[model samples]
Target: MYTVNQLGKMYNLSRSTLLYYDKIGLLKPSARSEANYRLYSKNDLKRMEKIATYREAGLSLESIADILNSDDTNSTTILEQRLHSLNSEISELRKQQQLVVELLGKDSLVRTAKIMNKEQWVNILRSSGMDEDDMHRWHREFERDLPEVHQDFLESLGCSPEEVSSIRKWSQ
Candidate 1:
């Protein structure tokens, strides 16, 4: 058996977070002391381990609670949803990273990337009579020559992450 403090320290969780979990009916103590202090049994400790594991895997507290408490759980769906969300986030971050790399590549051997709004780029493209096909080829050629500048140029035009990714894909 363990007190809340003991269990929290063992699991690297704060007392308040554990308390919140309990309050939310996420992880109830298996027993109580005579003084009504929360007493977690061995089973509760194991449950906490699972909770921590899921959290580290990027599962939300609510989702963890559902997994722990719900009948169906639907763990496969939960995990798949989390996986897809992570992939989308990673894709966006990659676009931003490519932009930064190109910007730095052009300016200097610096390590940071900055951004501009999208409309500024569109106006410049309009002035240049840049169409989709031309823009597509531009990305390919720019990437072929300068390596990273293609994404940066697109970003300078104020393109969204998805737009940048789409342009890169089509250019390929």
Candidate 2:
């Protein structure tokens, strides 16, 4: 048998956290000392480890409890869902990173357009086949004056200067 403090130390949990688990009936001490100290058994420790694993995988305490109690809950199904969500999050982050890399590569073009005070970004957007109405809506909502910023963003997509100029003229 392990005392509350010993169990807490082993699991890297606070004494209060273990007490809270006890109060919630998630974990019950196997025995109590004559002095009324909480004593956990080996089986309780193993259950705590399972709780920690589920918590690490983003399951809420309530959800973990449900899974533990339910006869129909399948561990494989839960794992597959968590894996899918993590993969989707990773894919989104990768796309954002690629966009940032493309923007950084057009640093020189960005600098030149900023100096010109011309809407080079509008040209860039037009070159990229981005809708004029969408650009107008974006400009109105964002109140951003730097067309060169958009130009740099578009140039990052590998558009030619001629194409960008044509789009800029068409937009006007």
lDDT at 136 for candidate 2?
62
Candidate 2, 1-172: lDDT as tens digits: 9998998998899999999999998888999999999999899888889899998988768867777766655666666777778766754654465455456775535443322212555687788887968876664443345565544543444455676556445544
Residue-level error in angstroms, candidate 2, position 50: 1.1
Error of 2 at 110 (Å): 18
| Cα lDDT computed for each candidate against the true fold | 0.78, 0.70
Q: Where is the poorest 10-residue window by lDDT in model 1?
A: 109-118
Give the TM-scores of the predictions, in the order they appear.
Answer: 0.62, 0.53
Q: What digit string (tens of lDDT, one per residue) describes model 1 on residues 30-110?
A: 989999999999999889999999999999998887777666548777888998898668657756766666666766854
- lDDT of model 1 at residue 157? 55
User: Model 2 reaches what TM-score against the true structure?
Assistant: 0.53
**What residue runs in model 2 are displaced by over 4 Å at the alpha carbon?**
106-172
Q: Which stretches of candidate 1 lie over 4 Å from their true place?
A: 71-73, 110-172
Q: Which residue pairs in candidate 2 have backbone atoms (N, alpha carbon, C) closer than 3 angstroms, thus clashing?
A: 121-147, 121-151
